[model samples]
Target: MLESYSRCWTEIDYAAIAHNVEEIQKLVGDTKIMGIVKANAYGHGDVECAKALQKVGVDFFGVSSVDEALHLRQNGIHDSILILGYTPPEHFHYLIEENIIQSLVSYDYAQKLDAYAKEAGTKIRCHCKVDTGMCRTGVIYQVQEKNMDQILAEYRMEHLIVEGIFSHFPVSDDLGQESAAFTKKQIELFEEVCDNLRKEGINPGIRHIQNSYGILNYGDLKMDYCRPGLLYMGVTSDDAIPIASKPDFIPILSWYANVSLVKWIQKGQSVSYGRHFIATKPTKVATVSVGYADGLHRLVSNCGLEVLIHGQKCPIIGNVCMDQCMVDVTQVDDVKEGDVVVLVGRQGDHRVTIDEISRKSHSINNETLSDIAGRVPRLRRREK
Candidate 1:
């Protein structure tokens, strides 16, 4: 069994991913699922999370960078890795040789990849990123209108394969008419682009657009394949996006830290950097070995952040330092040193969710989890 000495570690439940994938499979009946393991599986451990999802029969893994894909390859993961983010021109050759699928949004970028692939006697399978409404890293609809044929004529080479067509929804979670209408427009545009390509004798292999929110709220968007990242860990920003098919999904990560030091302070005593938190009473404070440096958002300061100690809820006190935080365990009876503090998961009936923390910290759920940096160890949970 793997454990941590710092008392602070991320416990990843592989079974939860399996459970979530099963739910998604039932929802998207007949459609393939391209598991989005980008950003180290949204800080849920990429290699392990991808493997766990693979055990549940996921088709491919999606990442955001070449370095992330390379990490998986080095770890002996042979499953296909799709680089969803923009690949730099300098690394196009490396991307081709490594058998990693990349997204192409510019004609000039495609030409370089084509030249490299042809010289290496290999063909790179890439997806066309349509900037339907996201306005991010995709070919604009306006640009395509002016030079679709010209662009096609430039890179109509045998070494380049357009394997998939995808677009991103701007706001799939907001329950506003404009948000829904805009998302609908993006879906319509994605289809139009692919339809135009097919008419021009171009066959885009996989057609995907539904992200985590899209897969849940807009099932129609889950056409050829669905890419869901945050949902795999059992949370979604969009309440409309159903994940588990059950009442609710179980979060896959639990963050815990051991009580490093238990101390007492008189009333009016201040704690931590900038002396932000003061003792309201003769209080007991326990230092936890976790901070923003370990991916805990600094904005959580003065927020009603709670952690589980001695099976009881304790409020986090003071400004969170780079490597430590203080939690008030004064109300809890028999609380002593070395008791485990639940930072981001359940313990008994009390729990602290990543969504709750993210809201308090003024960030998104994905950023809250994926920001969990290194140094803090991760403990992998397996079923018997």
Candidate 2:
């Protein structure tokens, strides 16, 4: 039985990951894909997913920090990795040692990193981020000469190799007129920055502005690379707005647990903490070996969340505990301990998705998937 081996586990379909990459390749054509594998590949297992992605011809990877980049490197991932977030100055040497690219967030940050690289007698590869509208990081985008001057300074730094320039979209996923206009302006401003740099005789290395949403909506834009984080994982938020053209991306991960115990309760008996559920008549309750500690949100308790047992949807009863939750499995035929329980995946003709769990938990798909704890093992599988 599944319970005999593991209380809970995540099954990753490598074939599905490959399929999603192939679908994305078809959409973007020759534009290289920087497979975003940060946050443990959105909790899908970074090493495993990176290996799978590398096998499928993805030549670049994007991570959040130097540590994540090193994690990939230590795990034998030799692809070019770009850190899309901040890295402390003290760790600048690790970036050079590991041959990882850093995102130059601002002119001041660039100065500091360059100074450090100069002191170490080495040049660090970087991608300059232009704050085209998100207003989070990078040199603020302006068509004026001052904006160009700051960007140009990074390219001229002797210790820094400014190989690429990129920006992010705050609302490229939204097709609404207001949002579309904002997205369009962001693209235009980013392009203007790159064009201005080129006119100044700066190669600007590689220019990428599309994220997962950007690839779906504005893929026609010419860019050197496209960074697909969630799209590459084959799932989007449940509340995600409609896009121009939705690709047929296959989901790559499924969650499962095991039935730990089953019992019959008499009328008026309460189950779990807070006595939230009272049996009107005789009811059969099954304890599942997974809970909030396993990344199942506590807010989902008694919130109409269902699990699958013997291919039947069973309502989760009472409050979810740290390591276990109760399910009303009376309708399931011959429910027994050690039976497989599908938490976020298919069971017979029924399926529960990450978006479903996100909706019920009042969270987004990324948070829902990335919240899955590391304690639960991620086992790789290949479809026939």
Candidate 3:
């Protein structure tokens, strides 16, 4: 028998992962894919997601922190791990020893890394990040032309190897022509930087610029490599931008919980905190043992969100509690204690997607998935 804890669990479909990888691979043919598994595979269970992605032939694992990389290493994930976020200078030695790739955004930081690599007597593989107008991370574009050249020419020591050059698209989701123009500008600037480096007798390998949105909408920007994060989880940036010819994606994660209690709430009685829901008619309410604390956004309270109870969609009543939520199962006549309720994922012909939740919560799909905490046990789905 399945453990009781499995009643409230996440089911990850490995085959879906393979399908998504093949789809993206076809989209960016011959270019390598750096599967962004940062934020614990965007809250889909990091070690397991990385393992599944590696099985599907992901070329590299991208993470945000040293600790995240170490977690992958601890799980026996030995593939090339790239720490895309800023790593403190003090942690350079640790990055060097782990054989993990790091992104350098500043010349001074690059020099610090060079000094450490020289002391260690080994060449450190590092990628140079050009801002290209993101204004978030990386070296700003206006200064990059001169500063990048100096970093590669003067600041670079014998022990530091320039492995890759990349930039990010700030508004790939905004499909307006202006957004396209800006993206084109960034890509052009990145290409010019590469050209300049080559002219100076320095070849920084793996020039990449396409992100998840860029990979789908802008085929022209898919260069030597593509970094795809959210697409791996079957989330598209914009519904208006059609991805018609690609392989169909299956959402890998499913959220489910069993009914802890089933009873009748008298007419006029309210449910949950703040008495947000009042029963005009007698209501059959079922309490499920999972709530906002478990990563269900509080915004889902009394909104358009619905869950499948006995394969029928039921409205969520009142405010969702920190550890529990009540759903009006009035129409699901057969629902009782111990019946299964699926908050996210398929149930019969009905389904609830993270996209739906995101729309209701006025939040991004990436945040919705990644915020599902350690409290939820992820059950690995077996092959049929």
Overall local distance difference test of candidate 3: 0.79
What does candidate 3's lDDT look like per residue over 1-384, in tens digits?
133465477877756788888888877888888889999888877788787788877868889998898888888989988888878877777787788888876666777778888887888888888788787777666534445655464225677777887888887666688987887788777887788778878786878888888787675555888988877777664343554245466677788888999999898999999998999999999999788888888999999589988888998889989888999988887777788888888888898887777878888888888778788887877667
> Could you give candidate 1's per-residue lDDT for residues 177-197 as a string of tens digits?
898888877777777777777
lDDT of 3 at 305: 85
All models: lDDT?
0.78, 0.88, 0.79
**Segments of candidate 1 deviating more than 4 angstroms:** 1-4, 142-147, 150-155, 238-247
Candidate that beats the other on lDDT, 1 or 3, i.e. the better one: 3
* Of candidates 3 and 1, the better by TM-score: 3
* Clashing residue pairs found in predicted model 2: none
TM-score, cand. 3 vs. native: 0.93
User: 1-384 in candidate 2: lDDT tens per residue?
Assistant: 123348989888866888888878777878888899999999998888888888888889999999999999999998899999999998998988999999998999999999999999999999999988888889988544237789999999999999899999989889999999999988889888878888988898888989988988888886889999888789875545688876899888889999999999999999999999999999999999999999999999998999989998999999999999999998888998889999988889998888878988889888999999999988776456
Best by lDDT: 2
TM per model? 0.92, 0.96, 0.93
- Kindly report the root-mean-square deviation of model 3 from the true structure over all alpha carbons: 2.2
